[model samples]
Every structure is written in structure tokens, then in C-alpha cells.
Target: MDMTLLSRLSDFEWRIEAHGKMRVPAILYASEELIRDMDNKVYEQIVNVATLPGIQKAAYAMPDAHWGYGFPIGGVAAFDPQEGGVVSAGGVGFDISCGVRTLLTALKVADVTTVQQPLADALYRHIPAGVGSTGRLNLDDQQLDEMLLNGAQWALKLGYGREADLDRTEERGCMAGARPEAVSEFAKKRQHREMGTLGSGNHYLEVQHVVQIYDEASARAFGLAPDDIVVSIHCGSRGLGHQIGTDFLREMVLQAPQYGIELPDRELACAPIESPLGETYLGAMRAAINCALANRQIITHLVRQAFAEVIPEADLSVLYDVSHNTCKVEEHMVDGHLKRVFIHRKGATRAFGPGHPAIPEALRAIGQPVLIGGTMGTASYILVGTDESERRSFSSSCHGAGRQMSRHQATKRWRGRQLIDELAGRGIIIRSPSSRGVAEEAPGAYKDVTSVVEAAEKAGLSRRVARLEPLICIKG
Candidate 1:
């Protein structure tokens, strides 16, 4: 992170002009402090991404950029298929469709304070969490295929959620063009018993209450008010998504040479978008996306049951569900022409602006809700997409307060039990199967979320709407 390595375009924008084998420039959106704190590897990886074939515009990293496989975790890049575009598994990360969904409840902060412990216990009991956790539903091979193809709609058909929930979800509950057949048998087996379970590592279901509202109009559009209770679930495709990334990355690397792809880094292994391998990977990846959508829907059902057990009067409804991983086809204005390109967002969330057809009809005028997750002990924020973001970074925004330290380093610094007790004293209930998991996700392990969001807003990535603080957290 040498300051001289990049040209400062503005207070929140830095640029690396095209050099060496780079096909386009590399842009990073962050404040001067955030840029100075970023690992040098982020600069290396993002520059490498610019060398990929058919890449459109420039390779961009969000304010929360951090070192990661191939592309930086907060990387964003678009590629054109007609111009020999390539798809990289590493750019999408192992956790495909890893996202967050916030559920609004009828109760207020006062209502939850009375039975917070019971509610936490009920959620921990009802929702399976931690590594290798399995859920109540065990899908057979046939059922698994059906679930992969149908996504959350399949869960609704099975009485897991309501029809209205799909309206607030990305892809309207099911992703199109999911070829379940492309998913390997082993991958299917790994997911068979994982549906509805929250896998370990930075995943959780938290009960939060709004503490502040930044944009009154947007907050009202999102049905938010002071002290309103909301449950936010953060998880993803579990083993199935990891298996897909593993299966495809290996193939992509081995076949890169055959396709005349000279990868600057093996982790950036990719194939021509028109290649058979590319098509197969897309099929499998889309299926994993569906798997994640279905998984969240089922978890929502479990959360509802947990709430009913603790507070029967509570009514939970989907506010918004958005994924931060995977590659997607989107239309963008490049060089004054509207063109279709495949946009890869690793640890970045899509913040489609208002008036986009893809947004839910009711919320379209306001814009997509961009949910930014914070550590269990910190505060999360709700932001709305801005039209400026579409032009600035392809409608991409920071996913979270990017990790500044590794899990191992976090454990060394703090004991999980002690951290839990400390968080508990702050009126935040912590429930987890493993104390070590809690330690690994210590609030100190991540960059200041407030700073990250502020940088994103300054960069015109999104507009903050509301801030939420944790009341109860069920960690994986």
C-alpha cells in the first residue's frame, strides 16, 4: 500500500494507470486512511485482474478491500463475452451467493429486551449452526435437484416461507439458467443435509434494533422507524458452493493453457466465456446460487418458528435479501454505449439504483436496500443504492467491515468466553456452539465499520439509510 504506487483521483478514489500486461486501469475506492491500511496484496491482485481478456472499464475495489484469492475480496470487474471475456472462480470466492437478509418484525426494542435470552436460546436451538451442522430437512437426490433448480420457491412450496418473501429477494427467489445436472454428485451430497443450516466462519443470525436513521425518505420506504426490531441472517451456499468453486477452479487452471489463457496468477485461472468449461461452471455456479437462496428461505422459516416460541405476537417479514458473491450478466454503459457484460463481485454487494427494472416494484423508486453486516458486537447499517454508484463502480458497494486480522490472530488476542461475557454486559446476547468461533469473529478483528461505510458513501457507492445495533446474536 505505497501511496506513490497510485495516483490520487480524489479523497476517496485512487488509480493505477494501465502498465505492463494490464488491459485496463485499476481503481480503488477508499479514503486515504483505508488505502494506507490495505494490504499491498490487494494492489497486486486488482492489477492482475486488469490483465484478464475482454475486461471492460477498469478493475475496481471497494472501500473494504482486503487480500484474498486471485481478486481482492472487495473486487469488482466486468467482462464482455463477445470480446473473449473470461470467468474466474477465484473472483467469485468459495462462498458463492454468500449474502445477508434482514427481516422486519412488528415488535420494538422494548419488547425484545424482556425476553432476549429466551429468544436467543430458541433461535440457537431451532437454527442449526457451526461447522458440519445439518438441518431438519434431509433432501434426497431428487429433492436436492428440485431445490437447486427452484431456489426459495421450492422452500415455499414445502411450507417453509410465504409467497411475499420472494418479492423482496434477489432474482425473485430462484436464479434462472441453473443446470443442476452440472453440479457434481459429491457437491449434491454435501448439500443434502445442509439446507437451513448456518455454516461456520463469519455467519450469524442477529436480532437488532434501529438506533439511527440517516435518510428519512429512504428509511420510510424501507419500512423502518426508530427502535424497530429486525432479524438479520448472514450465511451462504455452505458446502455446495465451496465444492462448486473447488471443482471449477481446478478445471479452469488445468485448461487455461489449452484456451491460450496466460494467467498472471494461477488463482486467477479462467476460461473463455464461450468455452464449454465456462458454460458448465456458470451452470453449476447458478445452481449454487439457488441453493443459497433456498437455504436462507428455510432459515427464515426456522427463525419465524423461534420467534413464535418466544413471542407469538412478533410478525417477521423480509426487508431485503442480497448476495455479494458470484458473477452475473448485467447491462452497463461503457464508453457511451449500453452493453452486456458479466460482472464479478467477490466480497462486494450489488447496489442497483432506483428505477432499475430488477428492483422490487414497491421499492424501485427508492432503490435497492444494501445491507452492510458488522461483527456481532458492532452495529450494522442499511444503505440504499445510488444512481451515482452505477456509474462509479458498476453498482457495487462494500460488503462488510473487511477483516483486518486473521481468525488465528484474533483467537490469540482474546479468549472467546471472556469476549462473550463482555459483549453480554453491553446488552448484546451471544449464543454459539463454539467459543472459539466467537473469538475468531471478535469486533477488534475487523476495520471500523463506521469508517468503511462513510468512505463508501463519500465514494458515491451508496447512501446510508439506518443504523442497527445488535440485541441478540446467534453465531455459527
Candidate 2:
């Protein structure tokens, strides 16, 4: 992160040139100020990622880059299977398919403000949250398998959500290639009661109002307007995802030597793309992605129930849903030839530009919606993918205001009770199961989201569409 050590390519691009076993250079997109604030570990992890087999173009760190397990949290890299590429467990992260989904409500800020506290209470009562929270749905083994395979489509079939919601979701709400048989029984048991639950640790459900529109066209496409109310759900695959990551990461470490893959760090353990273990991990990982999609769908239903109790005529419709942590098989141009590659985005969102077939047809002309979540009580933003992004970083962008400190460090710095009271004074309502959980996610513990989004736009990764200011937050 130090200026003296980096090779500056431009105001928004910095490079760590290939050296030693590195197959490609490490490129980071961020402003000088953000770069200086970043942990030195991010530089080391990205450089380590570059050393992996069959890495393409470069190992990239987005504007919100931070130190993570193996690759930096905001890292992006693509690997070609035909070129001996490998799949890394650390790259996809533990909370598989952890993402943000915003829903458009017919109500406005004025309608919510009048009944804010009671509405917040209703939401907290209806939506299960916090560590080890269990939802109303208790799945049997058969139902669990079905949900794992069907995802949001399963939820819709079960009357949790409408048919139209699937069209606005990534991969149409169910990632292909999910192998329920590959998922361990232990992982399945862990998630049997987690559906519709919001697990703890930075995960939340917030009610927000559209405060600004930067791109008129995209804003209209996303159904945004000044004072319009929206509910955003930020969560993931919960226990199943964690168990899958834990199981495979341990297995990959043991299998790495057999595959002749040298890991710079044990945490970066991986298997060759063609290997059986790699295929198995991918199967399990995709299932977890489906689990998350289904989980969010169920929660969306619960959110509707809560809103109906507070405001009888409220209509909550899906805007878009996207995942951040994933390793997706996609095609990209390399050396003027199209190449099929596995793109691993850790704490990074897929920013498919306009006309990308993966995006929903209704919004194809504008591009994929890239939701950037801010810390508690801060403003979040909705940005659109751009064609320039496809060329620059394999169509990836930052996920959020990357953590500035660890949860332990944050808890030591601020008391939850005081933080809650402070936000309450600012007209923000905070509802949570534990005051301690609140302390660990204090707003000061993250980088400035506005600055991060600005750097992302300046680097041409995504174009801003609108800004959202939080009215109430229900923390897990």
C-alpha cells in the first residue's frame, strides 16, 4: 500500500509487477488516499494470487480491497480450464453467494416516518435474525435436497414469492450445475432451519429512501425516484455455505500436493479444474449459491408479511438480486479469441455490462445492477455495470465499503448501546438481538463508501445510478 513500493499506472491504477513464481501482475484500482488506508496484507495476498497456476491477465483488487483469507477480499481473477486453471476454496469465501437484494415499495419516506418505530418492531418480530436464529420453515431431508437444487424457484413453487421475482434474480434465482448429492449431510442439517433467517455479523435488513439519482436512464430502469422507499436484504447461505467452505478447504489442502499445485499459503489451497475434488467442490459450492437465493426469497416473503401488517396496501417488488462471492464460469476475450474461464470474485460483485445475456432482459440495455452496501446508518448506492468494466477487471466491482478493522477491534472501540442511541438520535432506528453484535459493526469500522464508489466510477468499473439513505436497520 505504500507509494514507494507500487508502480503507478494512473490515478486509479496501481500495479505490483510479476515477480518470482507469479504468472501475472497484481493490479489494484483505487484512489491514492484509499490505497494508503488499505492493509498491507491486501498487496501480499493479491501478489500471492498472481502466483497461482493458469491465472489470466492479472489478479485485480477493487477500490474496496482489504485483507482476507487468501486472495484479498475485493480481489478478482479469471482462470482458464484449458490452460491448467485451478479452483480455490478461499476465493469463493465461506458465506457462499452472500449478496444484496433491494425491493421497491409503493410507499415513500413520509409514509414510513409516521410509523417508523412500530414498523421496525413488526419487521424484527416477523423476520428471524441473529446467530443461530431459526425460521418458520423446518425442512425435512427431501425438502432440503429440493431447496438446494431448486433455489428461489423452489421458494416460488412453495408460495414464498411470485413468478416475476425470478426474472430479476441472478441466474434466474437458481445457479445451474448444483449437485445436491455432493452436499454433505452435515451441511444440510445445519441449514435445515436457517431458511428465511438473517444470520449475524454485518448481515442486515434495512429500509431506505432514494436520495439522489445520478443516471436518469438507469434509475428509471431500476424503478427509483426521490423519496421512494425500498427494503434491502443483505445476507447469504448461512451455515451450509460455511460448512461447505470448511470441509472443502481442509480437503483441498490435503489434495493440493497430489495435484502438484504449490500453495504460497495453505489458506490458498486449490485443486486443478479437471480434478475430481475440484468438480465436487464446484458442485457443492453451486448448491450453496442456490441455498442463498432461496433463503433470500423466503425472507422477502416474510418482509412482505411484515410490511402488510404495518401498511395494508404496501406493494414490495423485486428490483434485482446479485451475489458477490462466487466463482462463475464465463466467457471473455483474450488475445482476440474467446476463452471460457472460471472467474473468482471474493468480496466482489459481477458487473456485467450492457447487452450481457446473463443480465435480465428488461434491463439489458442499462447493464447489471451493482448494489454497494454501506455500514450501518450510512448511505448505500446502486450502480450499473459498464462495458469498460468488462475490459478492465473481468466485469467485477467492489461489493461494499470494505472493513477498516476487525470485529473485535470495532467492538473494543465502540459500545453497542451508545452507538444505537447515537443513530436513534439521527432518526435511524436500530433493532437487533444483541447489543454486542451492534458494536462489532459500528459505521466507523468501514471505509467511506462514497469515496469507494467514486473510485469505482472514476476507474470506469461501474456507473452510479442512485443513492439510498437508510431509515431503519434490523441487524442480525
Candidate 3:
């Protein structure tokens, strides 16, 4: 984290020139304070990433970068398959397709306040949460495979959600190329009862209200106004995704030598993109992505039901849904030529700029909606991708206020019951199965979200749209 260790390119850009076995430079986008606060392991991991086979451009880290398994948590990199590119399981974290989705509600802040406690209790009762939580649906082997292959579309067929919701979702709620058979039987079993449940560790469903609008034009495009109520769901594929990552990471490590991959670190184990192992992993990974999308869609349906019980007239509509962790095939301009590449985004959100065909047609002029989640007590922000971001960092941005402390450290520093009481005093209701879970996610345990978002905007990664504050949180 030493300032002198990197070459300063600008206020928000720092670079480590390619050297030794490195194929390209490693770039970090952050303010001076944020860069100094980053752990040294982030620098080492990114440098390690630069040495990987077929890596393109550079290995970049966002403002919220943190040390992770192989690549840094807020890392971004692309690879070319024709150039012997590799697909790494470690590049995608255990919580595959972990992401956030926001729902626009007809009610405003004042309406929510009238039944805040009732609504909170209803959501807590309706939405299954906590470790090993089970939802109402229990799929058999055949049904599980269908869910894995079809994602939210499967849920919609079962009367969980409407068709319109797919238009606002990434990949239209079902990721293609998902080979359910590639997923292990044990992984499918683990997800059977966890379809609509919010798994433990940093996952939550919150009722939030917009408090500030940063860009009027973008805010209008996203259908946001001051004091409007919104619900945000943050989670992933649950046990299925974790098991897939575990299964593949172990296999990748054992098979790397056979593929002629000289791993800089055992955790960076990978197989060549064209290899059978790599293709199989991608198939299963894509299935997990669908699992996450289906899970979120089901949760949205549950949220609607909860609202109907408390405020019958309230209408909840999908604002946008986006995933953070995955290796996606995308086309990018490389050396003045448009080339296809695999983009790995770990703990980073895809922020496709305006006019990109990938973005939903309705929101294309403004850009993709980048949802940035905050802690239970802090404020979350909505940002839009910028054209400059595509050139700067592959149209990627920070996912959240990166953790500055471990869960153990957070538990030791704060008591959950007391913290919940404190949050309640500030008009935020907290509901969870475990008090320890609440303590583990103490707001002070993370970096200043406002500072992170400001750095991201200044770095041209994304532009802030609106700010949201939590009114009720159902944590896991």
C-alpha cells in the first residue's frame, strides 16, 4: 500500500508497470486515502493476475479493492480464447452471480412510515432468511434441473412473477449455455429448498427510500424521485453456487498441470478456455448464474406478497437487476479492433455505458443502472454507466462499500442487539434470525460508501444517479 510502490497516473489512477513474467500492467482506481488503506495482498494478487495466460490489457482494481482468494475482490480482467486464454474458478467467487436488484414501489417514504413496523415484520415472516433457510418451494431432481436451466422464466411459469420483469433483468432472467447436467448432484440437492431463500453472510432484503438525486436526467430515466420508496434485494445462488465453485476450483487445481498452466499461485488454478474442463466449468457456472436470477425473482414475488398483506394498493415494479461476480463473454475494443473476450468481474458490477446494445432499450440512452449496496445503517446509491468507463475499466465499477474489517473483528467491536436498538433509534428497523449476524455486518466495519462512490465517479467508472436510505432491513 506504499505510495511509492506505484506510479501515479492521475488523482484516481495508479499503475504498476509490467515486469518479470507480467504480460500487462496492473492498474488501480482509487483516491490516495483509499489506496493507502488497501491491503498489500491486493497489489500482489493483481500483479499475479497480470502473469496469467492470455490476459488482455491490464488487471484492474476498483476503489473498493480487497484481498480475495486468487484475484482481488474488486478485480477486472479480460482474456482471449484464441490466444490460449484460461478460465479460472477463483476469478469468480463462491457466491456466483451475487448481485443486487431494486424494485420501484408506488408508495413513498411517508406511506412506508405509517406501517413501517408492520411491513418489516411481514417481510421478515414472508421472506425466508438466515443460514440454511428453506423457502416454500422444494424441487425434486427434475424440477431442480428445470430451474437451473430456465432461471426466472421457470419461476414465472409457476406464477411467481410476471413476464415484464425479465425485460429489466440481466440476460432476460435466464443465462444461456447453462448445462444443468454439468452441475453436481450434491450441488443441486443443496439448492433444492434454498431457491427463494436469502442465504447468510452479507445478504439482505431492504426497504429503502430515495433521499437525494445527483443527476436529474439519469434519475428521470431510472424513474426515481426524492422520497420514493424502493426495495433492494442482495444475494446469490446460495449453496449451489458455492458448491460449484468449490467443485471446480479443486478440479482446476488438479488439472492445471495437465493443461500446461504454470500457476503463480495454487489458488489461481485454471484451465485453457478451449479445454474440456474449462467448457464444463463454464456450463455449470452459467447454471449457477441462472440459479441466482431465479432466486432474486422469487424473492421479488415474496416481497410483493408481503406488501399486499400490509399495503394492498402498493405496486412493486422491477427497476433493474444486475449481477457482480461471473465470467461473461463480451466484445471489447482491443488495439483498435473489436474482439471477443471473457470478462471476469469479482465483487465488481458490470456498468455498460450508454448506447451499448447490451443495455435494455428503454434505459440505453442513459446507460445501464449500476446498483451500489450499502450497509444496514448506511446509505446506498444508484449510478449509471458512462461511455468513458468502457475505455477506462471495461465498464466496471465497485459493487459496495468494501469491508475494512473481518466479520470476527466486527463481532468483537459491536453487539448486535445494541446495534439493532441503535439503528431503530435512527428509524431503521432490523430483522434477522441471529444477533451475531447483525454484529458481523456492522456499518462501521466497512469503508465509507460515499467516499467510494465519489472516487468511482471521479475515476469515470460510473456517474451517481440517486441515493437511497434503508428504512427496514431483513438480514441473513
Candidate with top lDDT is 1
Expressed as tens digits, the lDDT of each residue in 306-344 for candidate 3 is 999999989999999999999999999888989899999
Candidate 3 global CA lDDT score: 0.95
lDDT of 1 by residue, 226-304 (tens): 9999999999999999999999999999999999999999999998889999999989999999999999999999999
Pairs that collide in candidate 1 are none
Cα displacement (angstroms), candidate 1, residue 430, comes to 0.5
lDDT per residue for candidate 2 within 125-234, as digits (tens), equals 99999987899999999999999898999999999999999999999999999999999998998998899999999899999999999999999998999999999999
RMSD of each: 0.6, 0.8, 0.7
Instruction: Evaluate candidate 3 by giving its C-alpha RMSD to the native, one decimal.
Output: 0.7
Q: After superposition, how far is residue 182 of candidate 2 from its true place, in Å?
A: 0.9
Where does candidate 1 stray beyond 4 Å? none
Q: What is the clash count of model 2?
A: 0
Give each model's clash number: 0, 0, 0
Cα deviation of 330 in candidate 2 (Å)? 0.7
Candidate 1 Cα lDDT to native = 0.95
**Residue 300 local lDDT, model 2:** 94
